[model samples]
Target: MLRTVNVTRYIQPLREGGSLPALAEADDDFKYVLKFRGNGHGPKVLIAELIGGEIARELGLRVPELVFAHLDEAFGRTEGDEEVQDLLKGSQGLNIALHFLSGAITFDPVVTQIDAETASKVVWLDSFISNIDRTVKNTNMLMFNKELWLIDHGSSLSFHHAWMHLEERAKSPFPFVKEHVLLAQASLLKETNEAFKKLLTPEKLQAIVALIPDSWLEWPDTDESPEALREAYSQFLITRLNHSDIFTNQAQDAREALI
Candidate 1:
């Protein structure tokens, strides 16, 4: 389980992506960008963030530290904005907190000379998870300390949205990789796929899925319990791992056009 923190103050909201995430101060004296369950996307986004972001880190990619924040309804009472108050009130309990990268700036591929391998690894990871948010229009990447850090994985792992179609969708290739900001610069798609695919063992996948809070996994429509959903996610990842080549080739083809 990720470290749990108590949110002490409700800072202002950040209207970055579709989700209205907010900056808040926690008990640990650190600020974090909090993704609330009350948002339109709901708890599945949190589940994706946990599994997708952690999987990226375990694969040797850079990611921000995650913390499970405990929110008190009182914070909502203090918020002046009616919209934010509603958001806070709806998310009175647990939320995902991304450790604030205070001075980090949004990554701009135009000025950055990213190495081929690094870009490919990121593109490969995005393709593997079927993330549609890493396009040139919205990279979901930040630069801090002269290094790129991936963020906002709430949109990854979309197969989980419908359990009935998950397996079939798992094997489908991600065409959106062509829009990935790094695809043009990525040169080692096959090499990165071969190297990192081994890291996602069944045990490792299970462990990563287990980190998601049970509350987030329980959907009213799904008959599968949290543990069952976790296992399903693990299997989906394993299956997706086997199907990596198709997407890797797609990335390579797109890279050719871009370069």
Candidate 2:
């Protein structure tokens, strides 16, 4: 289980995100950008951030530390804003806390020189997760201490939206990957494939999926239980990894056309 910290203060809202995540102070005395399970995208997005961000770290990407932040309803009583109060009240249990990177600047691919290997790995990883957030316009990357740090994966794993056709969707090709920020500079897809193909085995995939909180898995509309949903995501990632070469090739073609 991830280390849990108590949220002590609701600092401010980050209106940049569609879900409108907020900054807060935690018992750990560290500030965190808090993403609530009760947000518009719901808990699955948090699951995606957990699963996807961990995978990126396993593959040696720079990702901000993720911790589970506990919210107490009493904190809501202090907030004067009704909208933020409602969010705090609703998210009275566990939520996602991304360690606040105080001076990190958003990465602009045009002005930055990301190495081909790292760029390829990031692009390939996004393709695997079907993350559509890292475009030229919204890279979802931060440059801190002169290194790229990935963030905001609340929109990956689209197959989970329709679990009945999970396997079919997992095997389907990705057409949106062409616009990936790293695609144009991802010149080492082959090496990236060779390295991670051997790394993200079924056992590893299962372990990563298992990290998702059980509470995040249960939804009224879904007949599948929490464990079943975990299994579904594990299988989806493993299957998607098996078929990664398809998108790798697609990225190479996209890169050739762009550069």
* lDDT of model 1 at position 140: 93
lDDT tens readout by residue for model 2, 92-119: 8888988999999999977998998889
Q: Supply candidate 2's per-residue lDDT for 124.
A: 87
What lDDT, from 0 to 1, does candidate 1 have?
A: 0.87
Error of 1 at 182 (Å): 0.4
For model 1, residues 1-259, the per-residue Cα lDDT tens digits are: 6899999987888998677898999999999999998888789988888888998898888999989999987877867798888888888788898999999999998878789888988999999988899987898999999999999999998887766777678788898887898887788888898998787787888888888887787687777788888888888888888888878888888888878
Cα lDDT listed for each candidate: 0.87, 0.86
Q: For each candidate, C-alpha RMSD in Å?
A: 1.2, 1.1
Q: Judged by lDDT, which candidate is best?
A: 1
How much lDDT does candidate 2 score?
A: 0.86
Residue pairs clashing in model 1 are none
